[model samples]
Target: MGVIRLPSQSRLLCFAFHIIFILFQQTTAERELKFVVVVFRHGDRTPVVNFPTDLHKESEWPQGFGQLTKTGMQQLYELGQYMRKRYSNFLNSTYKRQEFYIQSTDYDRTIMSAQSCLSGLFPPTSSQTWNPELPWQPIPVHIVTKSSDRRLHFPLHDCPRFDELQNETQTSSEFQNRIQPYKDFLQTMAVNTGLELNNLRTLDNFQLWNTYDTLYCEGIHNYTLPVWATKDVMDKMEKLAELSLLSLFGLYETEEKSRLQGGVLMNTILKSIKQAVNSSRERKMEVYSAHDTTIGALQIALNIFNGKLPPYAACQFFELYQESSGRYSIEMHYRNDTSKDPYLLTLPGCTSSCPLEKFAELVSPMIAENWSKECGKKDKKKDIFIGFDVAVGLLFIFDLVLLYLLYHYGRCRRRNNYQDL
Candidate 1:
């Protein structure tokens, strides 16, 4: 009312300030994440085999095929230490029993890896030292079995759907094309090994994949691989292993299928994080001990397949942080090789730091069902038989009545015939 008008620039500045203030307040009001879900590949192990006819096949390794090695235990222990250090801020000064959770596939190696990692993660404090002699405390590691298992663990045996997927994968155009050169290479190797190339496919067990994993793990642990196993050779083997994993679960053609493997896991992780953010529970770390196949499958499902496969002891981490302004953000860390710094992954639609809601939305399409509502329409023509037992009983009664009538009619006809005679 003072006939004086504010400058347009000043008015715009005031509006900007208001928006910034509101955003800042909103950011400050948001909560920090306390929950975490970790998914990891198992640690190192011995080569699954030497060669088909080689005397050392399956006997060279002390623990036999696909079992975890000492080196694998060490690798997981180191990973546990890394997790402890990285999440120190988020976790309590002492390990709060309730705040942590671990899940693994029900393989000896995976279960053992999870146990070993826990050993490194929460070493016994002085107070918890045992018997004034040894410093050991039992920590629980949860596992999901192939049957009734939601975690999608490996050596995923006995799944009909998974088997179908694998068959489709082997016959797919992409797989056939990719393996054509490898098929020739196998033929050459067959000549060298004196084993038939055709037999190689048929004779190979799941151990083929395990052999590749063990060798890669050993190489990482300073156990030099044979000259025959060059970086290129290992790379090819890793790809093959990944292909096997895709065969297990990544067979669907739609984006939803993509999301199911990738998005479902991601969603599970986010939900855990959200729960952590809201709850006062103590556990800040979640560990998932699994196989390289799990990593490959999840990556493929998420559409984030890095060129190389995730080797044994390879780890992927999702870190959540609260900024000064109070907004929450996320960072992804990946460690494939022991010598390198953890690689950072910037999720699509997510920044080096991403919002929780955005992260959920990104994977929602993958996890959400894609069936049409119209397709779910009920068939009115179909009888809704309540209590199948009762329906069966009624049918039995109707059958008895018909039988009784037939028997009486026959008797009556017989009596009439007797009278006529």
Candidate 2:
């Protein structure tokens, strides 16, 4: 056969096409989503608790404090619809217990938020329809009582080391420096908000956060702010609230604090990811209905916190993808605003799409193998035995000393009697 020489332009075009083909393949390979885990805060609602001096009362809300309002339900429902649209191809048209799971913190708002979201996520089809009047089907939203739910709760009160860490965070130079300039302003807030200065600064209860929340909620609902809560004052209070939130899980020995607070939840997520990767089951989604603190703790642990309180219905997504090359990677996205798309959250020390193995390694330190032990909790039974042993030894030493004293007194008496005789 006669050899045909291609024109120079044709040769360049062929090389360009080859490069484009390779790039397209790589892009396609990376886009195969395998599984997703969503952690979302409960939708907008009445404040969980009121401040001492507040204009709004529980009776003012449609439901009492901390309950989901109609608006809150609609927010979650829209979130569900968004999710359904986003993952249309990945999930079944109808809800399958084997493929999808949802969990919520044990609270009226969260449980109801989960339910409301499910209503939009899996509206009944003709086959699933029990009643023609209602398009919603009851889907289970699993929950453990707040006392027992360690996975979704943040700033666990049972962890002693975490408590100690908070104490240290307060004393740390970084925290002190951060709050130093705000000292006079905090005192001013204390006077205006009817809270003790010490209480406002304390990180345990996040009193500053509560103050900000009440004001923020009232403003959201069109209630007039307290005269003291001017725009500038609210702005300052907001900054302190953000600082208070950050101080709960960081600002001193962040890794150790995360191990106790956020790490627990992260460990659960990592385990779920691994199971999805290894298992043959078709489980594709896990949804967590929780609080701002829950999202904050998790983000802090991952070193990706945006330094602001997560708004109502804010969501963090951990999506697992199996590339065409057979390797899995994780991509994280955060949706804090309904008006815009979720922000891509890149894990520190890794790219936005990090290899599964590397992501695990980076987060391994925060996961607690023994949560109780790491919390510096001693075994109660062991402590009791140790106390008993110490008490018995001390009693035996006391008995010996008493016996020696008695014997010595007896000898002295005998010698005196002999001299008298």
For all candidates in order, the CA lDDT equals: 0.67, 0.90
Candidate 1 error regions (>4 Å) = 1-33, 49-51, 131-136, 146-148, 155-159, 191-208, 211-239, 242-264, 278-280, 322-329, 368-401, 407-421
Clashing pairs in 1: 35-276, 44-72, 99-282, 99-283, 100-283, 259-366
Give a tens-digit lDDT track for model 1, residues 189-237: 4654455566444224544455565566567646655667777777766
Model 2 TM: 0.88
lDDT of 2 by residue, 188-235 (tens): 887887788897766448678887888888888888888888999888
Error of 2 at 39 (Å): 0.1
Strongest candidate by lDDT:
2
User: Each candidate: how many clashes?
Assistant: 6, 0
- lDDT minimum window of 10 residues, candidate 2: 199-208
Please provide the root mean square deviation of candidate 1 (C-alpha atoms, Å). Answer: 8.0
| TM-score result, candidate 1 | 0.73
